[model samples]
Target: MSAYPTDRQPTHTPVMLSEVLALLNVRRGGVYIDATVGLGGHAAAILEASAPDGRLLGLDADAQALAAARRRLEPFGERCRLEQAWLDHCAAAAARHGFSAVDGVLCDLGVSSLQLDDPQRGFSFQQDGPLDMRLGDAAEQTAADVVNYYEEADLADVIYRLGEERRSRRIARAIVERRPLETTGELAQIVQSAVGRGPRRRIHPATHVFRALRLEVNRELERLSGFLASARGLLAAGGRLVAIAFHSLEDRIVKRFIRAAGSGDDAGFRSLSKKVIRPSADEIQRNPRARSARLRAAEAV
Candidate 1:
């Protein structure tokens, strides 16, 4: 329970605690993997519960997130391992350190609080910052580049299909007319102006657009598909895979993946959590970010 303040505060709060702990089925001497180890909140809890000889291999694409996780987990000493890598190839990365048959794998599918809080990362529409949205240190396509270079139709499709914005076309037109969006504040303002600034809703209008951009920048969905496939191959018999998804789309993917993994004859896994587990109202009140989290789990056959 050590929380250190850095230049950028981590905004991610690990959700669905009790459910994930139960689903993990941690055992002494077992090996575990926190496939999306962001700031070590869930990883810390897992390390404590699976104490003594149980080892945890935590992986994250964000180096800053990994550094935060390492700091939060420093007390664990040799019992924990932190690796900087995309979750899609984390299984291979895990094996590199001699964890070939892990007992459990946990992936929290939402962007970490750190990613959102760090203004320069550009995951938030609330804060003014640069338009960089890379998950890892990879210097690939950024939100800034996309906003400046993508055609009107492409931007509209990104906002419409990924963000589910009803006014995507108008927003896209507004964005295109603006010519260049150099910062998060500029982009958010354009969106607000197009939508005609109304009373603050439950969420900001630009929230989904930022999500869409981040997902595109990081190739989130494609990586998730690869991770699910690799995770099945990495787990041993009776091993469990616990996932916490923050949105409907992610939950749907997890639901479908678990179902496919549990099918007979050629099944890769068995259902551990038949239904998704949501955070308690108390948890949500304590950490508003937990309100949308959903946890699901499966066991390797």
Candidate 2:
């Protein structure tokens, strides 16, 4: 009973939908904010679960994605408000929309399927397009800018730390030798050449490099940090904060944030998920993109 067409459905399945709903504990008359409401899939579900009186504030940096979300959420009328903004601006956006201290908040971190499926966004190595990997107009740099201009040492560091790639030095050396790379295909080829496809390799050799470049171009980690720092203050007592992270680095940050908030003598938060919730086998089979998703949730004290 999906609202999206069959062909477009696969591109934007809301990962762990049931889990998100359970974690947020959506209820009628509740106020919620979808910090990364790409395509409005989750927002629609939340509105339905909350029924007639619930309100949602949806935010996204990508204008096109925001526009799509607006259309998808139109049936809810004024109950859903869509905004084009980064997750780090969630607190401000919530305040502006009179959603301060909402009943629940959700932050789905990492790139969306909309961005990856669009070859023009350059988030995936599987598709050939411009090396531009900016998540939105707000990004000051692009994957091409980083690939064509960064020093070898800095590039290596970015690959190693952000991408978690062991052969970062080798990859960076290869990229430097082939300067002025203009497209994702060219960069993917260079990385693949430098890091040969191992017999047991299940993923593309350039996966890590592309991930690193996208993270750098969008300053994702920095913004996630900023969002986490401000998230608690925007929640009313007993309000839930749910975050779904797609990578280990992002998960680690969320895990640590929740852990710290629940530890002190004056602890102002409580862990709602004892361990991180991950997609079940059935969910993964239905939506392959859910494989790496990890959800962590906490409630304000």
Candidate 3:
């Protein structure tokens, strides 16, 4: 019974929803941030567990996403704060809301189910929609903009580096010749055509290309790097930070950041998790979307 429209196909399931509550160690009177809070599902649960005087601030770059979050968290009234902001700017957002030095932070670094399910949003290669892939309002370029604007070599670089597509040069050449791909389905077709005949299916040949486009459009990597550093600054002493990443590209960054922070030059923090925690078989079965989730936690001394 997902809330998203049927055509959009409910791709989000709040991965590791229960694990987020356990790791945050949430308690009464505590405050936390659900950075990249797509739908407010995890934030709502965190607020409930840390209830009485506990408050939760949920932030996301998409206004539409924020609108939906506001409704989902409305039951908590003033206990929940919803905003349209990137996680990297946590400190400034805190200052504006008269909040400071939270007891815990939760970041779920996965895209929302809404974005993927909505064919019009163009995040998925399954549907034939426009190439627009901007997550926030200020996105400078759409996927189409990137495809049509970048030179063949630049496009090759993007596909090669981000998508990990080995046949990047060939794909890029095909893309340039095709020129002005109008829709998500159209682009998928172009890539498919370039790929030629193959097995019936093998994870959608354009999967990597779509992933690279989404990450680039949202500036996810840069934001993640900044948020990791900024989150440390926004934590009170002994505070904890929990993050859930969905893919190797994201998990690798989270892993390195925790490793460095926990073993800083001055030993500023203690690593709560030496290894990643994954969802249980039951959780994965209930929400297949949780399959790729990797959870990591750390605490400020």
Query: lDDT at 148 for candidate 2?
Result: 86
Give each model's whole-structure lDDT: 0.84, 0.89, 0.82
Candidate 2 lDDT over residue span 1-301, tens digit each: 0123435633378989999999899999899999999989899999999999999999999886787788789999989998989889888888888888888999887777777787887888898989988877889998989988999999999999999999999999999999999989999999999999999999998999988998899899989989988888898999999999999999999999999989979776899989999999999998989999999999999
Clashing pairs in 3: 8-117, 12-113, 128-185
What TM-score quantifies how close candidate 2 is to the native fold? 0.96
- Number of the candidate with higher TM-score, 2 or 3: 2
What's the C-alpha lDDT at position 210 in model 1?
Answer: 84
lDDT of model 1 at position 8: 50
Q: Ranking by lDDT, best first?
A: 2, 1, 3
**Between the candidate structures 1 and 2, which one is better when assessed by TM-score?**
2
lDDT of 1 by residue, 94-115 (tens): 8797887788999998677777
Select the stronger candidate by lDDT from 2 and 3: 2
User: What TM-score do all the candidates reach, one by one?
Assistant: 0.93, 0.96, 0.93
C-alpha displacement of 296 in model 1, angstroms? 0.9
